[model samples]
Each structure stands twice: as structure tokens, then as C-alpha cells.
Target: MPWSAMRRVIDVSGDGGNNSGPPVEQARGRSVAERIVINGLAIAKDHPPFAYAGPVPLEDYYREAVIGGPGAFVVPAEDFNQFASAVRRKMIREMAGLPSRPRMALAD
Candidate 1:
């Protein structure tokens, strides 16, 4: 939260739906308006715990709905097991502020 910080990013990680709070698009828009970058990490199906794919194409939804600003992106985790690695990749990209390809695949 430092004023001198070069980049401001708010990472939003979750499964495919937004069942609470403001809609994903609305939040992404607001954050972009505030000069903050928004990135998403979509968790795939809970095969181990629940055994079902996500209700939607999370990576696609995230790209269109949850991420914004210059070089913003969404990373897809194949499942909960891939969450940590996907997050790590996302953090590296965001912190570096590098201009990456329009789409990035964060796989296991």
C-alpha cells in the first residue's frame, strides 16, 4: 500500500463462480479505474473432494471478466493441486511488470 510502489496489483483467486459480493466485471472495472491491476487464478474441479469440473470455463471467464489494465492476465490451475504453482507464476509475472502474451497457460 505504499504510494511509491511502482505497481499495484490485486490478485483474485477462486473457483469459476462469484456467488457473493460485487460481480467480477464490476470489481475488475473499478480496480482498473483506480489504477490497480487485477489478475485471476481459477481453480479447476475438485475431483478429489467433489469430483466435478467447474461450472464454467474459468480461464476464459477470468480473462474477459476478472482481469484488466495493462498486461493483466488470468492463470488457470488444472485443479486445487495446481493452485500453488499457478499463483507463483502469476506473482512472478505481475511483480516483473513484463508484457506477456495475451494468453498464458499455468499448468501442472
Candidate 2:
């Protein structure tokens, strides 16, 4: 199927980086170019420290990894406590097609 014809998103979440599938950066780039938003949910618990060293700040990792597109976004749950809420909010935002915002004026 043509990339532009894609209407749904593929949300992938995991506790570690690409150890089992295709490289993430390459996948993300293709998705972005096709106008497909890729939202991510990364778990920081229950993993080897070395392999999952990830971002010193976990949010930074999500920002760089999971959310990459014109309107891509991610929600870091930190621990399980925040998982439900984060997922809910992220889903709402994605489904709603981002919130309406004021237009910014650019200087000519």
C-alpha cells in the first residue's frame, strides 16, 4: 500500500530497544516519511541495566525514540503507577488529532 494511503497508526511499546526486530531508526524514518505517526511506550522496569541504560532521563528517551512524526507524541509512565493515566491521555490526544491551537505569526 502507498504510504500516503495509511490512515491508522502502529503503536509499539517494549522494555528494551531493537534486539528482536528491524532497527528502530530505520523503521521510524520510513513511518515518518509516509506520514504515519509512531507513538511509543517504553518500560524502565525489569531489564538489564547495561542493555536498557537508555536515556539518563527516561522522558528524553521516549521523546527521541517513540514519538517521531509531524504530530507524533509520547507519554512516559515512569512506573506502573502512572501507566494507565499516561496511556489514557496519550490515546485521547492521538485519537482527537491533537488539540486546537492558536496560529503563530511569522515575521516576513
Best by lDDT: 1
Clashing pairs in 2: none
For residue 104, what is the lDDT in candidate 2? 97
TM-scores for candidates 1 onward, in order: 0.75, 0.65
Residue pairs whose backbone atoms clash in candidate 1: none
State the number of backbone clashes in model 2. 0
What would the per-residue lDDT of candidate 2 be over residues 1-108, giving only the tens digit for each residue?
Answer: 555433557776665556667767888888888788788776556445533665455556667765687767666666666677878877887778854668999999
Highest-scoring model, TM-score: 1
> How many clashes show up per model?
0, 0
What digit string (tens of lDDT, one per residue) describes model 1 on residues 42-91? 87675556543545577887887888998888888988888889989988
